[model samples]
Target: MKIAIIGTGYVGIVSGTCFSEFGHEVVCIDKDAAKVAALCQGQIPIYEPGLADMVAKNMTGGRLHFTTELSEAVPEADAVFIAVGTPSSRRGDGYADLSYLYQAAKDLAPHLTGYTVVVDKSTVPVGTARQVARVISETNPTADFDMASNPEFLREGAAINDFMRPDRVVIGVENEKAATVLREIYNALYLIETPIVITGIETAELIKYAANAFLAVKISFINEMANICEAVGADAIALAKGIGLDGRIGKKFLHPGPGYGGSCFPKDTVALLRTVQEHGVSARIVEAAVEVNAAQKARMVKKIRDALGGSETGLTIGVLGLTFKPETDDMRESPALTILPALIEKGAKVVAHDPQGMREAAKLLPDSVIYVENPYEVCLGADAIILMTEWNQYRALDFKRVLATMNKPVFVDLRNVYEPNKMRAIGFEYHGNGRGHEKR
Candidate 1:
C-alpha cells in the first residue's frame, strides 16, 4: 500500500517508519523544509528509541521516503494519515486545537485522485473525523475519500515495540471498504491475533481520551495514597504492592511521584473533561485527578524545602533527572518544569543533570538553575540532593562520593529511588515520599 503520513512529530515519524517496516511504501510529509531535509539526510529531528535505525533501514530498502510537498505525495497514496499535534488551546479551557488537523485535510483534499482513506492518527477530540470529512468535501466536492479515526496507543519511549506489538488496535470507519483498507494496513498485527476493536468515529476518539484520563486517575490516586501513608505510619510502596497483587488492580501507574506530566495525560485529561462538559456531562473523577496532579507538583516543592530544614531560601540543591521520565528528552509538562521554577523563586540554587533531557530542559527551566553534564557534579557543594526524575544513571550513584561534596547530607528522593533505612544507615538525612518518617 502507498501511504502518506503528514507531520513528522513523534506520532507521525514513528507511525510512518513502522508502517514502512510492515512493507508499505510510506512517505512522511512535513511543511518544515529543514525537518524534511534532516530526515532525507538521515538526521532524525526527534529522539525516539530505535526510530532512526528503522527509518534508515526502510529508506535503504526503498520502502520509506520523506517529502515537503503534500500535493505531490497525496495523489499517489492509498491512505493519507494526519498525525499532526493537537495541543491544548491556550484559552484556559481544555479544548484541543484542531486547526492543524483541519489544515491537513484541506491540503490533502484537492490532490485525492481516487478512493483514498484519510485517517486521523493524531489524538484528536471526538467528532474530529466528521469535521475533517466535512472540511475535505467542502474544499473539493469531487474528491472521493473516506474519513477514518485510527488512534495510536504508542508510548513515547517505547513507541516501536508498542506499534509492532500493540495491546490492541482500534480503528473506526464508516464502510467496509475503509475498514478493509485499515485491516490491510494493520495486517501485520492481525497475524498475531491482536485484538482489534472496530467502532464508530466518536468511540475511537473517546477511547484515547478515556484511556489517558484513567491512567492519570491512577497516578493521582496513588499520589494521594502516598500523602496519606506519610500522615500514617505506613509505606506507600508496600501498600501499592498489597493492592496491586489483586488481579483487578494490576500494579501499573501505582507508583507515587511528583505527578503525571507529559504531552498526553495533562492535555488529554483536560481535553476530555472539556469534551464531557460540552455534552453537558460531569466528569468529577477526572476533574479531581487534574487538581491532584497540579497539587502533587506543588507538594514536591514543599517536600524538598521541608527536607532542607524548612526553607529553600539561601540553599544549594542538587537535582538528578529533569525529563518527565527516563529514556526520552520530552520536557513538556514535566514536574521538574513546575517544581524547579518554584524552588528558584524561593532563592534556592539548583544544579541538575539528566542523561538526555538537558538540551530541552534548559529552554524550559529558569536561568537561575544550573545544568551540568556529570550527575555527580550536580551534588558538588549542595546543601541537599533531590532525586527528581528516576533515570537509570541516578539509580546506582556512589552515595559515598555524593555525601562527600555536599555541604549538608540531606537527600530527598521524590521518585522514591532509595529506601529510608538504607539512607539512614549510610549516615545521611534522607526523605522519601510516603516512606513514613517522624516530624523534623
Candidate 2:
C-alpha cells in the first residue's frame, strides 16, 4: 500500500512512520521546508518514546520518505491521510479551524487517481469528514475518493506503542471498498484481535472528543475529591483506590493532580461543551470539570504560598517539573502555565527543571524563571520547592540532597511523591496533595 500523510506534525509523523513500519510505502508531506529537511536528516521535531527509532528504521528500510511537495506525493498514493493540525479557533468558540483540512482537500482533489481513501486522521469536529468530502467533490468533480474519519487516541509519551497495538480502531467510512482498504491497512494489528469499530462519520468524530472529555472529567473528579479529603482528613489516594477496585470503576486517570492539562483534554473538553451548547443540551459535568481543572491550577499557587508560611514575596521557589505530564516535551495547557505566573506575580523567582520540556518551556515562560538542567539543580537555593510534573527523576530524588540544597527545606509535593514522615526524616518540611498545613 502506498500512503501519503499530509501535515508532518505529531500525528502525521507518528502515523506515517507506523504505516511505513507496517510495510506501506509512506510519503509524509509537509509545507515546512525546514521540518521536512530535518526529518529527511533524521532530526525528529517532537519527542515521543520509540518514535525516533521507528522513523529511523522505516527510513533506513526505504519504506518511509519525507517531502515538502504534496502535489508530487498525493497522486501516487492509494490512501491520503490529512493529519493536519486543527487547533481551537482563536474566537474561543471551541471550534477547530478547518482551513488546513479544506486546503488539503482542494490540493489533493485534481490528483485523486483511482479509488483513494482520504482519511481525516486529525481530531476534527463531527461534520468535518462530510466537509472534506464536499470540498473534494467541489474541487475535482470526477475525483473518485471516499473520505473517512479515523481519529487517533495516542498519548504523547506512549504514541508509538499505542499505534503499534491500539485497544481498538474506529474507522468511519461510507463504502465497503473504503472499509476494506482501512481493514487491510490495519491488518497487522487486526491479527492481535484489536477490535475494528466501523461507524458513521459523525459518531467517529465524536468518539475522539468524548473520550478526551471523559478522561478530563475523571481527573477533575479525583482532584475535587482530593480537596474534600483535605477538608475531612481523609486520604484521596486511598479513597480513589477503594472506589477504583470496583470492576465498574477500573482505575485509570483516577490519580488526583494539580489539573488535567495537555494538548488534548482541555481543548477537547471545551470543544465537546461547545458542541452540546449548539445542540441545546448542557453538558454540565464536563463544563464543571473544565472549570475545576482551571481552578485547580490557580489553587496550586496558594498551596505553595501557604507552605512558605503565607507570603511569596522575594522568595526563591523551585519547580521540579514543567511539562504537563511526564515523559513528553509537550507543555501545552500545563498547570505550570497558571502556577508559575501566580508565583511571579507574588514576587517569587522560580527555577524549574524537566527531563525534556525545557526547550519548549523556555519560549512560554518568562526569563525570570531560570531553566535548570537537573531536578536537584532546581532545588538549590530555593525557599520552597513545588513538584509540578511528577517526572521519574522527581519521584526518586535524593531527599537529603534536596534538603541540603535548599535554603529552606520546604517540599510541596503536588503529585504526592513523598509522605510527611519520609520528608521529616530527611529534615525537610513536606506537603503532600490533600494533606493540610498541620503536616507541614
Candidate 3:
C-alpha cells in the first residue's frame, strides 16, 4: 500500500513511520521545508522514545520517505492521511484551526487520479468529516475518493509501542470501500485480535476526545480524593489501591499526583467541555474535572510555600523533573510551569533538572531558573526541594548527600515518591500530596 501522510508533526511523523514499518510504502509530506529537510537527514524533530530508531530503520529500508511538496506524494499514493495538528481555539471552544486540513484537501483533491482513501487521522471535531468531505468535493467535483475518520490515541512517551499494538483500531467510514481500505491497512493488528470498532464519522471523532477526557476525569477525581484524604489523614495511595483492585475499576490512571498535563488531557478535556457547551448542555462533571486540575496545580505551590515555613524570600528552591510526565521531553502544560513561576515571583531562585526536558522547559520557565544537569546539583544550597515530576532517577536519591548539601532539608514530594515517616526518620522534613507532615 502506498500512503501519503500530510503534516509531518508528531501524529503524522509517528503514524507515517509506523505505517511504513508495517510494510506500507509511505511518503510523509510537511509544508515546513526545514522540517522536511531535517527528516531527509534522518533527524527526528520530536523527542519520543524509540521513535528515532524506527524512523531511521524504515527510511533505510526504503519503505519510508519525507517531502515538502504534496503534489509529489498525493498523486502516487493510494491513501491520503490528514494527521495535522488541530490545536484548540482561544475561546476554549471545541473548534480547531482547520486551515491546514482544508488546504491539504483542496491541494490533494485536484490531483486525485484514482480511487483514494482520504482518512482523518487528526483529532478533529464531530462534524469535521462532513466539512472535509465538502472541501474535497468542492475542490474536485468528480473525485472518487471517500473520507474516513480514524482518530489516533497514541500517548507521547509510549507512542511506538501503542501504535505497534493498539488496544483497538477504530474506522468510521461512509461506505464499504472506505472501510475495506482501512481494514486492509490495519490487517496486521487484525491478526492479534485488536478490536476494530466500526462506527459513524461523528462518533469516531468524539470517541478520541471522550477517551482522553474520561482518563483526565479519573486523574482529577483521584486528586480530588487526595485532598479529602489530607483533611481526614487518609492515605490516597491506599484508597487508590483499594478502589483499583475492583474488576470494574481497573488499576490504570489512578495515581494521585499534581495534575494531568502534557498535550492531550488538558486540551481534550477543554475541547469536550466546549463541545457540550455549544449544544447548550452543561457537562458538569467534565467542567469540575477541569476546575479541579487547575486547583491541584495551585495547591502544589501552597504545599511548597508551607514547607519553607511560609516565606520564599532569599530561598533557593530545588525542582526535580520539568516534564509533565517521565520518559518524554514534552513540557506543554506541565505543572512545573504553574509552580516554578510562583516560586520565582515570591523571590525564590529555582534550580530545576530533568533527564530530557530542559531545552523545552527553558523556553517556558524564567531566565532566573538555573537549568542543572543532575538532581543533586539543583538540591545544593536549596532551602526546600520539590519533586514536580516523578522521573525514576529521582526515586532513589542519596538522601544523606541531599540533606548534607541543602541549607534546609525540606522535601515536598508532589508525586508521593517517598514515605513521610521514612523521610522524617532520615532526619529530613517531608511533605507529600494528601499526606500531612510527620509529627516532629
Candidate 4:
C-alpha cells in the first residue's frame, strides 16, 4: 500500500513511520519547509521512545519519504490520511477548531488522481468526516475519493508501540471499497489477529472522544477519592488497590496525583462536554470531571502552601518533573504549569528538573522557574521538594543527599511516589497525597 500522511506532527510522523515499517510505501507531507528538510536529514521534531531510530531505519530502507508538496505524494497514494491538528477553539467555548482539517481536505482534493481512502486520523468531532467529505467534493467535483474515520488511539509517550500493536483497529467507511483499502493499509495488524471494528463515520469519531473522556473521568474519580481519603485519614493507595482488584475497575488510571493533564484528556473532556451540550444533551459526569480536574490542580497548590506553613511567600521550592508524564516532552496541559505559576505568583522561587521536558517546559512555565540539568540540583538550598511528575529518575532518590542540601527538610510527594512513614523515619517532613492514615 502507498500511503500519504497529510501532516508531520506527532501522530502523522509515528503513523507514517510505522506504516512504512509495515512494508508499505509511505510519504509524510508537511507545509513547513524547514520541518520537511529536517526530517529529510533524519532529524525528528518530536520525542518518543524508539521513534527516531524507526524513522531513520524506514527512510534508509527507502520505504518512507518526506515532502512539503501534497501533489508529490497524494496522487500516487492508496490512502491519504488527514492527520492534522484539531485543537480546542480559541474562543474558550470548548469546541474543536477544524479549520486545518477542512483546509487539508480542500487542498488534497485537487490532487486526487485515483480512488483513495481519505482517512480522518485526527481526533475530531463526530460529524467531521462528513464535513471533510463535503469540503473535498466542493473543492474538486471530479475527485474520486471516499471518506473514512480511522481515529488514532496512540498515547504520546508510547505512540510507536501503540500504533504497531493496537488493541483494536477501527475503520469507519461508507462502502466496502473504502474499508478494504484501510484494512490493507493496516494489514500488518490484521495478520496478528487484532480486532477490527467496523462502524459508521460518526460512531468511529465518537469512539475516540468517548475513550479519552472516559479515561479523564476515571482519573478525576480517583483524584476525588484521594481527596476524600485525605479528609477521613484513609490511605488512597490501599483504597485504589482494594477496588482495582475487583476485575471490573482493573487499575489503570487509578493512581491519584495532581490531576490528569496531557495533549488528550484536558481538551477532549471539554470538547466532549461541549459537543453533547450543543446537541441538547447533558454530559453532567464529564462536566464534573472537568471541574474536578481543575479543582485537583488548585488543591495541589493548596497542598504545597500548607506544607510550607500556610503561605508560599519567600520560599525556595524544588520541583521534580515538569511534563504531564514521563518519556515524552509534551507540556501542553501539565499540572506543573498550573501549580508552579500559582506558587510563583505567591513569591516562591521554583527550581525544576525533568529528564526530557525542561526545554519545552521552560517556554510554558514562568521564567522564575530555574531549570536544572540534574535531578538533585533542584534540591540544593530549597525549602521543600515536590515530585510533580513521576519520571523514573525521581522514583528513587538519595534522601540523605536531599536532606543535607536543603535549608528545610520538607518533601511533598504529589505523585504519591514515596511512602509517608518511611520518609518521616528518614527525618524529613514528608507530605503525600491521601496517606493521612499511614502509621506515624
Which candidate number would show the highest lDDT if scored against the true structure? Answer: 4
Residue ranges of candidate 3 with Cα displaced over 4 Å: 90-94, 436-440
Model 4 off-target regions past 4 Å? none
- Pick out the ten consecutive residues of candidate 1 with the lowest summed lDDT: 431-440
Candidate 4 least-lDDT 10 residues: 431-440
- Candidate 3 lands at a TM-score of 0.97
Give the TM-score of each candidate. Answer: 0.98, 0.98, 0.97, 0.99
lDDT of 1 by residue, 1-440 (tens): 99999999999999999999999999999999999999999998878889989999999999999999987689999999999999998787778998998998898899999899999999998999999999999999999889999999988789999999999999998889999999999999999999999998899999999999999999999999999999887788999999899999899999999998889999999998888889999999999999999999999998988888889899999989988988899999999999999999989999999988999998989888898999989989999998988988787888888888989999988888886778888878988888764343
lDDT of 3 by residue, 192-237 (tens): 8899999888999999988998898899999999888888878888
Residue pairs with clashing backbones, model 4: none
For candidate 2, lDDT tens digit of each residue in 184-276?
999898889999999988999999988898888899999999888888788888888999999998799888889988889988888888788
Model 4 TM-score on a 0 to 1 scale: 0.99
- In model 2, the Cα lDDT at residue 302 comes to 86
The superposed Cα distance between candidate 3 and the true structure at residue 261, in angstroms, equals 1.0
Model 4 Cα lDDT, one tens digit per residue, 1-440: 89999999988999999999999999999999999999999999998999999999999999999999998999999999999998999998889999999999999999999898899999998898999999999999999999999989999888988999998988899999998998888888989999999999999999998999899989999999999998888999999999999898888899999998988899889988888988999989889999999999999999999999999899999999999998999999999999999999999999999999999998888887899999889999999999999998787889988899999998999999987778988889898998768533
Residue 48 shift from truth in candidate 4, angstroms: 0.3
Span of ten consecutive residues with least summed lDDT in model 3: 431-440
Clashes of each: 0, 0, 0, 0
